[model samples]
Target: MNEVMDVIRLFLPLIVVQLLLMSVALFDLYRRVSVRGQKWVWVIIIIVINLLGPIAYFIFGREKSSEY
Candidate 1:
């Protein structure tokens, strides 16, 4: 039980961050008009690739806005 707690303590922050990233990615995906790839493909990547998936989506999936 102590070992489980220790492990959880060590990884809990990372898990939380990953969940946050996933949520943000999914929310953005839902709201955006266009992404660099197809919506379903981005969804697959976000759901399947774990931490890197959402990071990749945030970094590369979004199309640049000319308005900015």
Candidate 2:
């Protein structure tokens, strides 16, 4: 039990951060008119690929804005 608690404590913050990142990515994806590739695919990547998923979407998925 002690070891389990230790592991959870170590990973809890990372897990929380990961969820936060995924939530932000998903929300951004929803608000945008376009992304680099298919929106559905990016949604899957952001939701299913864990820490790297949202990062990948943010880095590679977002299309350049024309509003600038």
Candidate 3:
């Protein structure tokens, strides 16, 4: 009860940030043409690895382009 509520409150911000990061990562993945690896693989990674997944995609999966 109270303990559960406290735990949720403590982690709420982290959960929100994770959702935000996943959404942004998925949006970028949908729009971009050239990811560093297979699109499906990246999608799995992003959804499965929680916090680190989207960050990994943003840092490593996205291919650098001259237009950037």
The TM-score leader among the candidates is 3
- lDDT ranking from best candidate downward: 3, 2, 1
Report the lDDT tens digits of candidate 3 across residue range 2-67.
Answer: 999999999999999999999999989988887898999999999999999999999999988733
Q: What shift in Å separates residue 21 of candidate 2 from its native position after superposition? A: 0.4
Residue pairs in collision within model 1: none
TM-score of each model, in listed order:
0.91, 0.91, 0.93
Output the better candidate (1/3) by TM-score: 3
lDDT of candidate 1 at residue 22, scale 0 to 100: 98
Overall lDDT per candidate, in order of appearance: 0.92, 0.92, 0.94
lDDT of 1 by residue, 1-68 (tens): 99999999999999999999999999989988888879999999999999999999989999897321
Question: What's the lDDT for candidate 2?
Answer: 0.92
User: How many residue pairs clash in all the candidates, one count each?
Assistant: 0, 0, 0
Ten-residue region with minimum lDDT total, candidate 1: 59-68
lDDT per residue (tens digit) for residues 1-68 in model 2? 99999999999999999999999999999898888999999999998999999999988998878531
What TM-score would candidate 3 get against the native? 0.93
User: After best superposition, candidate 3 residue 14: deviation in angstroms?
Assistant: 0.4
